[model samples]
Target: MPSVRRLRPVWAETPGTVPPPPGAPAPAAVAVQPGLDELGTPLADVTFVVVDLETTGGRAGTDAITEIGAVKVRGGEVLGEFQTLVDPGGPVPPFIQVLTGITTSMLVGAPRIEEVLPSFLEFARGAVLVAHNAPFDVGFLRAAAARCERAWPGFQVVDTVRLARRVVLRDEAPNHKLSTLAALFRAEVAPNHRALSDARATVDVLHALLGRLAPLGVTHLEDLADAADPVPSDVRRRSTLADGLPDAPGVYLFRGPREEVLYVGTSTTSLRKRVRSYFTSAEKRGRMTEMVRLAVRVDPVVCATPLEARVRELRLIAEHAPRYNRRSRAPERMPWVRLTDEAYPRLSVVRDVRSGTAHIGPFASQASAQLAVEALHETFAVRRCTRRLPLLPAAGAHACVLAELGRCGAPCTGGQDHADYGTVADQVRAAMAGDPGEVVAAHAARIRTLVAQERFEEAATVRDRLLAFARGAARTQRHAPLARCAELVAARRTDDGGWELVLVRHGRLAGTVRVDRRTDPRPVVATLRATGEHVAAPTAPATAAHPEETDLVLAWLEQPGVRLVEISGEWASPVRSAQSVRDAVAAVAVDLLLPRPPLLDDVPPARPGAGAPSAPAGPDVPAQGARRTA
Candidate 1:
């Protein structure tokens, strides 16, 4: 292997090479587990192999590399450079040939990846890897290593593109593209569409970024990875949206220019501080950055207690169906499996839950609801046929295969009369209404039978069906008790010697208050009773309220130190209900059972006029300036 030394007249001129202040983040917060960059090594002590690769195409594994260029640097000084061209084992695409100037003829005489990899690996050994859009170059290298059956060295990585986005503002540079950055930073070498020149430019960009970051206390190499994310320029400009938000526990809605809610979130402490975070790098998701960019105003709904804040957040998210809020947007779309109003009832997954019905649900999706229906069919020999059955049967009518298989009562053909079929229907209703012991027992028996016969595939399928049914029923049954209550009040002692009080009606949070230890609780309870919401009694299976809110209430009630202050309506479930059944079904861990739960359509709701939630759109970079990135 041969190494070339690229000489330069001037080393990097670091402007703010100041020392880090005490307790100041090196760049941002402390990392959980320190990587090589977080190992307290000063940036000067860290060696970086700024690398570039020109490939036959853009994709890895499918594309072959045509050339590689890398320059090793430490302490703001260039050490050595490595450059090579490799035959791609195939003709280069016409577009790539024109862009890279590496035609198929030029590559035909060069060594292949298998021959050149060893030399390059040796050159990059013991150095932190740096590249522009590191994933594209590094992904290709890792994929190459895998193809060659060689272990890709676990070297630390730094992405100059990402770093530049953080350190150099968009106003300073139009874009962080290699050529654009090279021109802005006044680099010694211009970046053409060649590997060595681009690599050389990236080294200059990296140094310039370091020079800018040094003032912000980015002294340690590890500091680069400590900050969760960088605040995009557009997002930061909207910091005024959080203005006037109070420092209190509350729900906050980010409203767009059209006054449409873009996101719903809650703050356990200060709404002002929490909302302000979205304008900074602290809010680290692309979708959120986009959300902040669109937000023109912030509406804060201040609450007395943290519990109330959380509940309000859930309600607002459901009401607004904010595109940025990924959860709690479509509570109405949650599928419920209902028993039809027929002589021999059949289970059907429905979005429009009828006023009166035997149903088990709030399943995550229609597929999951259908799985629960299948579990019922497997367990109770319930009618699986969808057609409406006549009360009087024809004399010459024939039974379907389910009747002979005993998986159904064949009520459609009069082989089983309505009276006899009603027995199985009654059992199904009982399970859905709360007591699912019989249903669970039946699934367990079938699982045992299938396992004994060595039909592992069928057994696994049955296992999933049972799990889906058991969990759904348990969720509904547990929520039903709380949902049925007319008025209920609870209290929990907070860590600050205050009491968190809540008024719940029919499983929905009606009112909440926080009373300090120094204040009298008697008056607070009276105030709550007078102002509590009037909730009409829900029809049976009883959780007419959003199941999510009911769940939140139940979890709060069951937590340690919570005490029931007052109660009006009966709040109780069957002694032996789906809860017990769920435990039993989950206990069965036979060999060959699927390691994961059955797959369901748990995807996010589709954006308006789109098939699914549209991904975040790319925003513009800053105007051209003095500093730049790779």
Candidate 2:
């Protein structure tokens, strides 16, 4: 990890450069200093902590941030600056380093997120934030806040990107990328894309853009703040589609004029960014651009897991027959390898899942799916020539050329018995399921067994299959979650060999309650029962013969007359758990509840919770999958 040194304010330094001890009082507050105009007249000037971050990747929640840079500027004068590389806690993609020039070696000694976030928050206190793409910077900052258990800095934002688009580029700028705007204004940028250098450049860009917009009645900060960035009405409409969106893996739909669907797509990244990109891409204007002018709204459906998102997206496209979506009949007819229902198992390609056979894939492309089926057949040797089974003998009564080639233990030729054939079938099924961890384990075991018996060639083939399985699974599973709502269940072993239950609603740290494994017959039982409704108990972990057991409490709570209860805490998510079901019952709750913003509006005759939240969405990991039915 790159080391992070805390940024000190030049105007008002803390008593000591080091942080005050946890229980110590925070340093005294600093008053804002006034600035002078060119004529020596006092001006109501304000300072800004202009910040920028270069991250390992774009997905804020999943990707580790690699570097941070910020400078405090007052009246266009630099007061103080800070910069540091961050240890991503994961591998840094080569392209990221190429772009940012922050190599892995640069971060080897840096502080982790847990330490840097608080210091940065304090440095940014009492200053309005200025950035090129404000949301991109803010999104990562907000995520850091959530991780550190702090609220986002309550400062206002000034976006040079938005300002240029709304005020200066009224003639339709060719491209609004930072580099483009910088060139247009003749602003010189540093050679490396280091964070602090970039932040300073952005501050300069803000000043230049402000000069252009000042003549357009954008002199005051408040005027620029309130001016709706003159984005295409279509862009604005599509942007709203991200409102109330769960931070899970899912697909979204864009609708044009007269409710005609314009686009259908999936994103393992931010749904907000994915949908927003269509309007902001370089191909911003053209035939598509004209259609955007007539665009009315954006629609979305959140999925739980990446697997679930892929499945749900395909299902929804087929069902809705949306106007913009391309015909995806290929996925439906994609062949899957399945075992025939016979005394001796026969492998064959079935084009559809609804063929009344147990099958694995409706692969997006048929070619890849066929290759997978062929590879499995070669490894397992399951009667590829196919001349009606049971014509010659029982399940394990014969041998084929594959067994002689050391590729298969021929069950069809009786070299392998029925029971052993069943074992091989199970292995084939596991590989088909596309889970690498399990496949690796099974293949490793097979290789070890073969190698110990001096079957080197067979071991090599098993090793090859393992590698193939790993690669295939990676491509298929690299998607976001599908379910929109889920109960995040975590089980960690306690020091005394017990288990702990820590439940978080949304991203807030709601509560931590432990369960003792010895006396508790079932730990899941205890937690589920305590959900939504309160069941009184001693502060310590449960003991044998306790007055209230988890099962009994849950059973009684489920009764018709039992009312629903709500747990309280610093929850910031829109979805509420245990409330709709346990209302009127004693609620197990936290008291430090923050007020919630409104949820996004749904399309088509309007469903509930559609208005945009009065406050913006909290920066947290999006929940995945389709919304669960209440």
Candidate 3:
């Protein structure tokens, strides 16, 4: 008690007040100080713990982890390392032993996963998680935590494999596997299927990926997290090419280094946004990626409306034949099913439509044209013989087997009366002119008969033929009116509180303009009229304006709220037309025969003028119409 009299005050001996012993070095300063919020933290200030686990098998839910290894890093400097062998509480499989090179004997005295996981969790606390194919390692840790009744802290995770796929090109590495990526980046340590070795390799890979992200403006943690979405360096360099583009509806052309158009595309809004998107991480198509990398400049054609943009895009694609454009570039080469201009007409699939010929299609392919022809022949007694038939039958002209089976009128051999054959020809012409009611009904009856007999395969063939013809017939009916019109004006409301106006002249896109809600549209309408383009009218004997263009115009006109502002010529679909009947029957057949929901009507009857616009019959059809005396 006498010796303690001289003791120093308690405050003097406090840890904060205490001084370091002599000759001891002061504690080194921490290079990085993380922010209060991880999302707001700078990439250089945050700590990352790249982890890897060797598990008993592929599935985390069913498999137990055997080893844990992690490296804690800040500012690309390793602060600490953790490694432990875990006893899975069961014998490790032979395949796992061979894969990870960890034997059962090595885990004999090791701590159980329940014990080892706690230490790893503490080591990785308050740090971002990183791994190659992160799902495999993080998933196992989460499953283990759940089984151990431990609260698993949610951590921001980064997958190096995903990062590598975005950062490295396919030609640079055959795949994004750990070993391949480690070798490609020349990591400080090679992955050997062991936890620590793989973890060390992944750390190097993480640093490499971070270095790559710095050039992409990834200075913040959130930006670093999004580094896996890659924008190629070349594409990124050319992003400024879109800076001059207007944020309006338009078509854009990406020009290559040689100034050749590389790609043609259209957007209904913000040409700048659409063009720049091709150079960003969001563009993932491999072909488009290559195209963007090769693109040196972007050219935009601003339009007053989206319809005009679409039409311009189609026209540009057809003209340039851009290597990157796959659709609408070859509409001129599409085939058509034509009824020949002869005494006795025969069905033929021809690429070049002659003037004054009754044709049924601008079919997608020769096969589709042939299918339409076959469906037509199955229903009508049209002459199938290729021979030229005189007004009166020639004596020695041999009749083909089609005549013997009553599939054709055999006008070439005089096997049928002239007036009778002419009647069949009229029926064929009516069907070709978008009146497919009789043909569709006959095929539908045949399909029902085949189903009644339990011959499903044969019925399916007939059903497919009917569907094909129905599709072509519908297209013809929808587009033929627009093609035949002299001039028309239509308008539809846009999503952004504007009006889209389309002008058609001679069945082709004449002009398109947009009217703002706050502005009077009279001036714009006058401007459109002044600058309206002139195009060839849809006429018989020649393939009409590209069906694709006509279809586009038709679709816009058919929109629910579209208004017909003006029309010089009549724009109509036939009343009680065969196309309407075909659509009704085909709709029901598709529901019943195809793998779809139950039919709306169990037995749909062919209803004339039921499901189509009403237009007068085409000019080529006889005044008598598609109706025939039985």
Candidate 4:
């Protein structure tokens, strides 16, 4: 808010030094600031108070204002001028003094902001406030008003810099800086660092910017805002690229100059409006802005249902790996914890998983998969060593430290015979194969003991592990049935009583369609099944598609109101009782316990009247029964 009088801001590009005011436009947000509402007023009738300030520093919270200068004008005629020097109650920085020529000595007897702010506010009242980068001036003014305990009048604001950028072409003006614009327009007054001279230069610049708006039919104040931030003419004409795109749910790809997909996106309501936003101010991402500049055409794939649209978008992103799309790009790299095929099977974290009944994963990262494996190791006497076990026990070989600590049965060194180790493997297999009770109960007991012993940090670690196990287990279980199915048909009611039907095969969405309200969906479902893509039988983990895709399908199937219309293969997972898992682990139970399969849910009932404290909870929870779409 400070300059020699009102022409320039001294805080130019001082990153992070000054905080923008509340509701200040995000930098990515193009032209026009918020806080100004009345744009309908004719440009000629609007009064503009072009103000500038000199401050002790860039920060509004810490800085003090030293001078204020503004010129009020309406219809190209001057109305009034407000000029003042204030006692900032502090010495000006040497750099600020050299920059603005305002010294501490000159402010010795000047009126403080407490007296100057009210007069300035009064002078600028009822006028549309104007400044080059209005946030700076408006922000400083508002801060001063707050310090003076004054209520700031909500005056509509116009930022000349933003306006100039929209009105003047890049070739016409290299930049939108006031000094540059003032020189370009040949203003009678030139900006010096002083506030009054700068404010005078801004006045000329604002008028010249307004003049450029005439041919664009932007004469009214409202027109000024609409006219702000226009894309280059070539880019503007590219708005035609959105033409012919359906006003319905679909995936849209922005093809670059070489016909390469620069971006992939979707719109559930209208592809036209969403796609058009890219060529307008609504699109603020720098990369997206550049993408629009290079885009030659928009190719759209319209889907009959929203779910189909979403699924298609994911598949397209995975297939093309478009540089502009940020998600669903390498889901195959997600980790899984599996039991290796060996004489003594044990936990292993792997990235590429085909089929395995004794596996639990699609964990978000390798670390999480490892944590889940560690949680499993903590609960069962499963072997921890990764080396292959010998066919026959080597009685003379020594066991690893893990075996001594009872964390493993030491199958590698033959401390436990194959038959005995088989028992541990079965328990580990049972937990990963969808009966999670033993893992849960054991962790719960362990967490309860840690909390009672005041080892909260250790308790929290157990909590995180348990929750990670719960997430992987729950997510995996959700995908299991859908992944196992060879073909399935399902439907959900749309708002209009119509049905949205989908065709899925081996966990990948094959096809989908929406039926009109009051129309029979039976024939439509049959047609969808007939026309659906031919899916080959899936391998274990059981999905033919990416874990992410299967997860989405499961989520849609599990949503309330969706009901299965037909099926070609198994859709139910056998319910293994939690009690069996607990009994299997009881033989190896020591102290640190775990919870049932749903790590975040299902804490065992506390012992009644035993005076035993409750178990500490793991960090998360889980729940679900596969929907009976039989």
Q: For residues 460-491, what per-residue lDDT tens digits would candidate 3 score against the true structure?
A: 78776776666566556556656656777766
lDDT of each: 0.76, 0.52, 0.74, 0.74
- Relative to the true structure, candidate 4 reaches a TM of 0.60
- The C-alpha stretches of model 1 lying farther than 4 A from their native spots are 1-229, 352-357, 448-458, 542-544, 590-593, 596-630
RMSD of each: 20.6, 22.5, 15.0, 15.7
Pairs that collide in candidate 1 are 37-222, 38-222, 170-622, 171-622, 171-623, 172-625
User: Tens digits of per-residue lDDT for model 4 on 1-630?
Assistant: 222223322211222346578998756644845344433566766778998888898888889888888988777777777888989999999999999999999999999899888888888878888888888888888888888788889888888888887768899878888789999999878887778888888888887777676656666777666566555556678899999989999999999888898888988888999999888867768888788888999998988887877888888898899998888588778888888878888789887665444777678778878888888988988887777778786668788788787777776676788889888888888787656887877877887788679787787677667667766665565566677778887777789877788788988999988888767677787789899999887666647787777766766765666666676655654354232333333322333343332322222311222211112211111111223331
Ranking 2 against 3 by lDDT, winner: 3
Q: Which ten residues in a row have the lowest lDDT in candidate 3?
A: 621-630
Return whichever of 3 and 4 wins on TM-score.
Answer: 3
Ranked by TM-score, top first? 3, 1, 4, 2
> Model 4, poorest ten-residue lDDT window?
617-626
The most accurate candidate by lDDT is 1
Error of 1 at 66 (Å): 46
State the weakest 10-residue window (summed lDDT) of model 2. 476-485
